[model samples]
Target chain A: MKRFSLNQATTRHWPLPDLVAGCAEAGVTGAGLWREDVQAYGVERAAALIRDAGMTVTSLCRGGFFQQSGWEEENRRAIDEAATLGAPALVLVSGGLPAGSRDIDAARAHVGEAIGRLVPYALDAGVQLAVEPLHPMFASDRCVVASLRQALDLAAPYPAETVGVVVDTYHLWWDDGVWDQIARAGRERRIACFQVADWVTPLPAGVLLGRGLPGTGCVELRRFREAVDAAGYTGPIEVEVFAEEVWARPGADVLREALAGYRSHVAELPAPVEEDDRAP
Target chain B: MKRFSLNQATTRHWPLPDLVAGCAEAGVTGAGLWREDVQAYGVERAAALIRDAGMTVTSLCRGGFFQQSGWEEENRRAIDEAATLGAPALVLVSGGLPAGSRDIDAARAHVGEAIGRLVPYALDAGVQLAVEPLHPMFASDRCVVASLRQALDLAAPYPAETVGVVVDTYHLWWDDGVWDQIARAGRERRIACFQVADWVTPLPAGVLLGRGLPGTGCVELRRFREAVDAAGYTGPIEVEVFAEEVWARPGADVLREALAGYRSHVAELPAPVEEDDRAP
Candidate 1:
């Protein structure tokens, strides 16, 4: 419970004030928010609401879309927004290939350069730019970074504090190589955010908003949690599910289920080894 | 045009007889087949039909489903059918996790052992078992083998003639490591089959039927064709798309479009280096 955070996306339609009050009442100490939701409620007001409720902002939903025009100004604004909201990380969903373009290698190189250009602004704002690798299904239209290795490589040239990677299970569980990449991210101190969601089948049209709540699908959620822990990540675990069915339900109901799933699947961290066990 | 083969799934609604006649009329000398369709039309009868039309069966659609209860018997039948139809290769779509199973590592290891078990049957039948690594999107429910590297690793222990891999553009296009893996496959002589399909977005529900014709989506079709060719795969280049929209159209119309797309995107193989030019 101490490490559990309900990402606002899990209850996307929940009013900002209600979400803050609900999180406080439910004893949740952290909340991951979206830029649109914050801007709609006024970023300062949203920040004040969370602060008054004595909850911390775990992360801001997004900052990247480097393929679009004016991405520089847009991302700078996002960094400012993250700083104003006291969020430590801004997630970046690197946009897909430019229109009518099939040059993926070039697009990936552009993402790396885009992040490099944003590093100074991110540093100044004290917000880590968390490069998220979306699922490969989105490689053509949503994101060019489809593996944790690519995200880490893109962040390698910048300081760990200024540029890092987001470990989101929904987009990464299908990858067999992710476990090693998670360990590498931790070794480099580049795992800035860890988000949890399950991989569900019969994905909806467009393949977005098809994520399952923690235990509703086939992902080895607890195994992923343990892997990240073993990799030295002790950060807040945000439950960031996006599904139409889940959103249609009451926010409180969804939050409660997310908490229950976390408790069942992610709460039992492995016990620490005794000093004697490590002795030769 | 001589290298083009139409996989039946691309024109799924066409009757087996009509498809055979259509291919013969269109000067398509090669065809890839599905087990169910062949069985429905009587494997012997279908083989006779193709043989009578002076057409060759390039490969069989599938054999592996190692997680199922009767996979050994099922795959044995598939091998026999492929041999009867004169297909040198039997493509295998390794099944996903058994119902409710979470141990993907164990599932993958089981696939290796299962293939080892079937190697004798495959070799005796004179059919190469071609392991296909499907897109990662199908990792959980369709196929656990999700990358060309993994497919090659699984095939490494077996004789190249008895065990090989399928290089499908739709499946391998997003992988950055595929070019090197293709070269490795060529060096190892494990490239049993080469397939082409484009990757259209806004993927329909279930995602199994969202593949596009060669030039209809963002895949670098020409690059994939050249990569496989460089890997020493000089076999039939089968266009194996699976889209509801394509299926809804007339088979002849779809075939013409497939041929046109192949010509525009995949037909221009790199010119062979001349002996005189190489003799500096």
Candidate 2:
């Protein structure tokens, strides 16, 4: 059976314990927890609660804002937190163009160097660093990784077992090469996670947190799923709807709606025609 | 000694002839005239006015909406209008995702096939089709051509003299591979037109018109110019600010501000570096 995971941000209104319990009630086998939620409740406590609730922690929300000058220590500590939470993956949104740095290449390099240093720690902690490419609108003030190819390239030298890429529809719906990239990532064994969110409104900050639920927009979710499934990825299909309006509603209602949307929209994707066809 | 090209949309408050005369009076040597402006004044009258004023038509606003089922005739006619205006290039914004068609790949193929049919006509008419990649925010509702690399790849198999890409900063400000792509376009001799506008507020369909003047926001205009020059591009830098707010101001004032900002910002860029240097 296909598995569903609710990213905690979808229900930021609910406490982590409640969210986990809610996911269990909704029959979702997994959950993607946010760093702030874990931090607020304490990582160890949140981990205990989630485990007791018997839910899969698909991925930890994030840990990568290394564009600033003195961020190495901060990043290392984040690695520790990810390990403590027992997350299978630690999603990293490389910080935006650094403050006062016109050289985006430099900012990107700073992120690369930071990732290089943090990888060993992540490997030690049994946490995979999943690089998440944000929408291009966030290039200036949020993240510099803006495409799957770039993300895959950044993770190239790193061990695939320790570093992978997260495929989120909202951020990647526009890329011409996204389909091919998904197939390549699958063949390379680097798809760490798959996420769903619709791109409807364009925010200045880019992360409007008002992402539409799947099928509410034009993203070919079914085609996208087929591409990932073809790539031999059988991971939790995490629904991380960042809609501010949607979150304003009751968490239980939102979960119910998300589940319905996921089934009607994402679940119908035809599995790829061939399996193990990625043979060299 | 850099030249300023007033995009008619910049002085949308003023009529076309008045804007042309204004450009002449202000020592702005070039202008990007829009289709509506040309159509209202009649192409013959508009062309004569531009020629008599001794001003160059940098480019005609656009000529491509190749997503629909039967758009070839309409597209061909737009190409004809571009040719009649004596504009050196016709900026082609590949239209939005077709309704009910979730297949972006198919949509892209349709765009390519449409362009393929139109290329010979463009070449014969002495006009290059300039493909402009809009910001990803408009990926669904506007242009599907959202990356310079994607645009370049689309234009690659075509003749550089027949087809090229428009480097518009406002639409592409947030792109990660910008400098590299700009440099590549320059090397390929496909950098047909240069445009500038700053991304300020969030993009609502209506507020997307709120682009900033050249020096207004955080865009590294100087760095961009350096990158373009380094790639051996010596084309006129057209100030194409699409600010609804600026248009609400007096037309003359917007032109004056754009002129002053362009001179100040363009002056700070480094002298042309190696056109092929990958590193800044």
Candidate 3:
């Protein structure tokens, strides 16, 4: 499908050029990239490679971490990088409670203010600062924005075009209120990016790299795809997985499996719809 | 303090007699017991030990896992055990999705039904079925009830005395709405058991353990204690940490630290209060 995207984190070991070539060879046209990976490969060169392959950079992995020092200058550069790559959305994983500071409410309030500071710059740069609410387990150390409601609340102060919320199934699959939040996000026009990852058990050490490839775990993948589709988000559906096991495999093999899993698990519709002729 | 409680899971390896002796020697009056440890030590004997030591079993560690095949029988026994121990609340960790089942809504609805079915028996047994919402990280394999709001909702439609909810700081600290929910639980008289545990970083594998004692992590424990207090809950404050590091130390040492942590991090009120002549 034209909307399918391979988030670079899914194939974390894959070289940028090789990933681009592999996607190109496989007729894939969209990608979700990480800041660190793109920077390592030289932003301009990576942009060129993807451009030459006629692929769209659906989103850039991050831009928030407001808790850290020098966040302003760093986020500005991230916005610049996203602009160069032609990515419309810069996903923001709002960093957790500032070191040793136990006040989560204060940390979260700071994130709102921090985002307000960046809204003007983001609007001018023509990039949507996509606030991604990570899984709650990361609330203490990695990301404080742990629910779709929080993300929407954070984005409410800014214009919908300038700021939006990401709907990553991995982070939100367990939430009973998430379905309603997704609908609310749709009503608010805040859904910027939709990512898919299955939740598997026996979470390894660090609790970071234990995600399952689509269809491999107990997540309702197709339901999420359908919900996002119904939410007026007709953009790229990025299959982003972060697991040591998935990364240990050959990049090409992992890519193939990712594509295959997306096809069998996420791409199918509940009932066949009339084919659209919008694509030229 | 009159409200302090030591949850047995904090010192998992501590023998029943030694733990009871340790608590008695330390002048602790309340405890939260685990089903396995009680069964392993002989329930009647354990009950007699705690009863003779002049300590109260504040609450029982569990009684939910509705997804399992023998759950009804298992839970009935758990209720009986709580009755035997004279514990007022039987905390339920609503089981995760059924095998190969991706529909979480169905699983959660089943939990509601399961709790409803047990309401009459719980009432007859003079034990409150306290529905505990585990952290979202355990939503897949351990517990699907992931928020205080959800737990309260499930406990709704039943009598407040028969069904209530557990408010554990570790499971609910990440939720911004929890403060309001804690207030709500107070309004509805659903605050059956109030628990305290700090959320530390780099969670161990399986994540069943890895909780920190109060003041060790970023959670605002005193704030939670104050919230519950404001919510009109004057119940036992159970210190329930389940980390390997905490368990490795001698039970007496851990108990002292837990008591000390609770004293410094949880018991000390922000404002001085009039002494209660209510305690005879």
**lDDT score for residue B205 of model 1:** 90
For each candidate in the order shown, give its overall lDDT on alpha carbons: 0.93, 0.81, 0.93
Docking class of 1: medium
| Regions more than 4 Å wrong, model 1 | A269-280, B269-280
Q: lDDT per residue, candidate 3, A131-218, as tens digits?
A: 9999999998889999999999999988999999999999999998888999999999999999999999989878999999999999
Clashing pairs in 1: none
The native-contact fractions of the candidates, in order shown, are 0.75, 0.35, 0.90
RMSD of each: 4.1, 6.0, 3.6
Model 3 regions more than 4 Å off: A270-280, B270-280
Per-residue lDDT tens digits for candidate 2, residues A11-35, read 8788776787777887877889888
